[model samples]
Target: MTTPTRPPKTRRRPEWLVPAGLIALSLVPIVAGSARLTQLTTGAAVTAENARFFDSPVPVVTHIVGSSVFLVLGALQFAPSLRRRRWHRIAGRIVAPAGLLSALPALWMTVFYDIPTAVSGPGLAAVRLVLGTTMAAAILVAFIAIRRGDVRTHSAWMTRAYAIGLAAGTQVFVFLPYTLLAGTPSPVVYTLLMTAGWAVNLVIAEVAIRRRARGPRRRTGTTVTAAGARLS
Candidate 1:
């Protein structure tokens, strides 16, 4: 009897694509923050109008460092290679706490930090406060979910937290065009743009989660069809 011919191996989609895109999207704010940090370290002249920011800088530093660690390392969690290699869990040990610190500092800044009245709006502050608080809660709940052996719930909650945390990255896209056109948006306009950023990112996150939820069913269907063919 002739040996059975095996089917050609199907090419697996690159699981790194999504995480790579996410990392690229998040780099805008990270690079900009790094540039500013460099300037500060090099003894750049401080403007009188914004002396407070430079003077009491711990919150900004905390926010930047925490955000960098969380977003960059967190994005890697989505890579299949990292997951298979078990590095995702290793990274999560750092990412989870970093996410909490990233969001809580933002909430703290929203509450205690003063913004220039001309550009500051209550609506934006409220948006920041709510998103930041929820992000922190998501991280906490995810941690608890994983400990309880509910991996699905943990994944969902962590995704939500990460979606919220990407607000800064999304904001770059929103503000750049507005700034180019308007030269400087009013407080109301600024609030709307920032809100749009968070809204868009969350929407994308939800869509991605839905698609992921459907993937297993699709694979199962394929497996069943192949088995039936073999029996026939």
Candidate 2:
């Protein structure tokens, strides 16, 4: 029998869980990831100096360009006024080229990506390679869309592309709590998280934007019906 004086149990999730999940899902590498992922998480390309910080052949140009372009792209998403006010266009013009240059270096570096250990089948490696390539191609198409004045297509492609770019940040944020509680190795956990997260984020952005797009159309139809009723 429950006492009437008892307060209802709160079912609040911890605030830290969000960041922890992001880190767990994004930042870490596989049980044995390509050295590239290791390079990636350490902020390898955040600055030109990172070239010196990394191995020769220096993923420097790629890192610098990718980091900077993504920063701009990610910022534009949060500023609706800026997005609608032509500022996003001007910024997009600048970021699109920069993003392409960044990918040139990234795609070139793919050969060094290591396959997962203990999984002798080529499938795991193949999946990573394909997804990574697909992400690069999507960004390139997004850049082209902006240049062609296809704003709707640009917005959709860019959101998916930028979500992939932002995956690094989100991955770092996802890797903590789940990994801690689940007790997975740092590398395997990170790799799975980042790859899985890319797909998840892409789907989520598409669904959310589609919903927002549909909402305005629905409201417009409703308003037209109301106006017609008043006329009648």
Candidate 3:
């Protein structure tokens, strides 16, 4: 008698893993921002860095609120289960506008405000301007793509926008430890850290998008193969 056939091994799809990771990775900025807001409201002893935010609070505050909402809500979109339900669409509505608001105010501040030399140099300023503009454009294009019923394009563009929006979160992880250990870094170091954050997020987003695109093609190939086997 032959031995019993083994059951087929299936790959487990951890769809929620990315979203969970995004939330966890973002906690640093979330906590820091909350503390700053509390301090600002309570008139606590503020440093020069904090005073800059108070000087031109509108754009800074707007960027903080909008980016926070976009990053937090956008993270939910990665959950496949939520995408099937009403959560995705509802979150999309908030995310799109919030992303635009976030990027626009940032661009405005970069263009018009006198950026503190201690915070950023010419290199970092230019990078932020370009990234801020691109993020805004990505959000707008994603909105148009969805309106035109191009779900794939919409998803790709939104992924890009979300990646840019999360750059701040990534930067926190990159520079916060160093800053704590050695105090504020030089402008060159700051620029490098900022660039690293953007690069890392964009690379990850591209990989995720490519993997998502391949999934449908893989399934179609499997279906066609099964049909051919049946005919044989």
Best by lDDT: 3
**Candidate 3 lDDT by residue in tens digits, 1-232:** 9665433445866988888889877675667667767776788775766676666777777777787888788998999888889879988999999998889999988887766788786488889989999999998999999999998999999999999988878988878788899888888988998899899999999999998776533232133231223111
Clash number for each model:
0, 21, 0
Which segments of candidate 1 are over 4 A away from where they belong?
A: 1-12, 219-221, 224-232
Regions more than 4 Å wrong, model 2: 1-53, 113-128, 186-190, 215-232
Q: Which ten residues in a row have the lowest lDDT in candidate 2?
A: 223-232
**Against the true structure, what is every candidate's RMSD?**
4.1, 10.9, 4.2
- The best-first sequence of candidates by lDDT reads 3, 1, 2
lDDT of each: 0.81, 0.55, 0.82
TM-score of each: 0.85, 0.61, 0.84
Error of 1 at 115 (Å): 1.2
lDDT of 2 by residue, 1-232 (tens): 9543433344755545543443344333321133554666665664443343345345544555554555455455445556666777777777666555555555555556332343223344554556556666876787778779876777787667666655555554565567777865455555566566566777877896696455432232133231223111
Alpha carbon lDDT of residue 17, candidate 3? 88
Tell me the deviation in Å of residue 174 in model 2: 3.0
